[model samples]
Target: MLTIIGLLSTTFGVSVASALMPLISVELFAVGLVLKAPHIPWWALAIVIATGQIGGKLLHYYAARGSIRLPRFMQRKKAAERKGRVREWLDAFRANCRKRPAWTGVVMLVSALASLPPFAAVAIIAGWAKVPVTTFLVTGFVGRFVRFGALAIAPGIVSTWV
Candidate 1:
């Protein structure tokens, strides 16, 4: 019971930290491996960690969405100009997403799994672009699950080879 609680807390804390900063996820996965080795199953650990990560990422997504909801009139001139450029880009992205949702989904999945383009950036952009919350959550969870799952299993695999 105590071990389960510790594991849950560790996964939750690490997930929140990683959502705020990308690199920490990898580091925490490594730490989890070292700390939980022999006692916990890799798949179980991965699932827990991934779930926590998704939770944290949800917070990030909502925060970005809220930020973008701020009144345009309040923005400074330079900020407004930058916002215009971003809006233009987002428009194009939305078009592509509409025309080829499968392609967009694949891209998002691959990027999330590989940690390419950074998950935080992707999450912020997705939120700002008003990507459907269901799509975001599903793709993000799948990607994170694969990523953290691989990380969780790597040490055991390496030990076998060595």
Candidate 2:
């Protein structure tokens, strides 16, 4: 039981790191664990990793929402100080997101599952768009759980065919 707890803790830590740092690649780590630690259940790994990922992404979400203060260098320019077609387009898109929140949630969920627009970017965008926290949490979690679970179990599933 202690060993199981330790493994879970490790998965959580690595997953959080991977979420914060794109280069870390938690998917690779999970697949490696499946190959090396056959004793751990794939679904358990998926849940732990997904929790850690969501926790890490929450920081980005909050920061984008201006709930978490950032250093001057990291902060975006003030809206009044910024001007451009891109800015206007972004403002329009944000308004659209607010008007069609369900659509935004679906986009976020798809990004979480497929990394189409990139989950990291979507996390920040969802915050900047003022997406409801509950929606972000639910969609992101469900997508991530399914994605990581599939990866964690893929090796065993494939090997069984041979």
Candidate 3:
């Protein structure tokens, strides 16, 4: 029970911190391997870690959503140009979301699972795109669980091979 609590706290902290710092999530998975070797079962640790990760990512998603609503005040011409470019990009992204939701979902799932383009970036994009919370939570949990599970088992597999 204490180990579970500790795992939750550590994974949550690392996931939240990685929203700003980045790559700490991977390190946390590695730490989970160390934790699994002695105390927790890998599958249990994976679930706990994945749940913590999704919880922390929800924070990032909501923060991005809130920020996206904030009014922008651009005083400089270059800033205005950049804003225009960003608006165009967002519009295109939104169109893709609407036009091909399945494709977008696949991208989301693959990106989350592989950590391609980074999970934090994906969360921010999902927020900016107004992705449903259920989709976010489900996909994020599945992806992170798979990732952490693999990390958790790696040491044991290596030891057996050796």
Candidate 4:
């Protein structure tokens, strides 16, 4: 099905660019617009895109967590430092978790909503923060569903309302 293909491709694309958050966000936004056209049912498109993006984020987060091994060229001592960096970042997040749970949730939610295309930055940060995986996935799904759903519907809504 076209929907399945779109979801699969979008997930692959977003996952591949998780490390390049700043760039992919914009591209995803544009792609969302294109996917919103009349030919595509807004619900299907939104669901597919939202699910795909979340799936991609999880993929990237786990990849960064070192589940996937790097190439020999990339496995030098300097590269190994990245694992420590991830630990440090996770520590920083844990330190703030108790003192600022509400703020953390709000900020993560906003960041997830506002983040462009891939929105991997929020996921990476969440992972670094060592936030519970459930929390991250829930916020991500809700934020993305709202954002992509709005993108899919706003054009029609405005055209009719205005």
Question: What C-alpha lDDT do the candidate models reach, one value each?
Answer: 0.71, 0.92, 0.71, 0.63
lDDT of 3: 0.71
Candidate 1 local accuracy as lDDT? 0.71
Clash totals, every prediction: 0, 0, 0, 2
- Per-residue lDDT of model 3, residues 87-153, tens digit only: 7887788788778867767777877788896787898888767787787888888888888788778
Give per-residue lDDT, candidate 2, residue 126: 93
The 10 consecutive residues of candidate 3 with the worst lDDT sum are 70-79
Model 2 ranges off by over 4 Å: none
Q: How many angstroms is residue 97 displaced in model 2 relative to the true structure, after the best TM-score fit?
A: 0.6
| Candidate 1: tens digits of C-alpha lDDT, residues 61-156 | 776666534457743344355666766876788677778877767766876798787777778767656677888889988998888778777777
The collision pairs in model 3 are none
* Top candidate (lDDT): 2
Q: What is the C-alpha RMSD of each candidate to the true structure, in Å?
A: 3.7, 1.4, 4.1, 5.2
lDDT of 4 by residue, 6-29 (tens): 754654466345434544553355
TM-score of each: 0.79, 0.96, 0.76, 0.64
Error of 3 at 144 (Å): 0.5
Global lDDT for candidate 2? Answer: 0.92
User: Which portions of model 4 show Cα errors greater than 4 Å?
Assistant: 1-39, 71-90, 116-118
Candidate 3 matches the true fold with a TM-score of 0.76
lDDT, candidate 1, residue 40?
Answer: 71
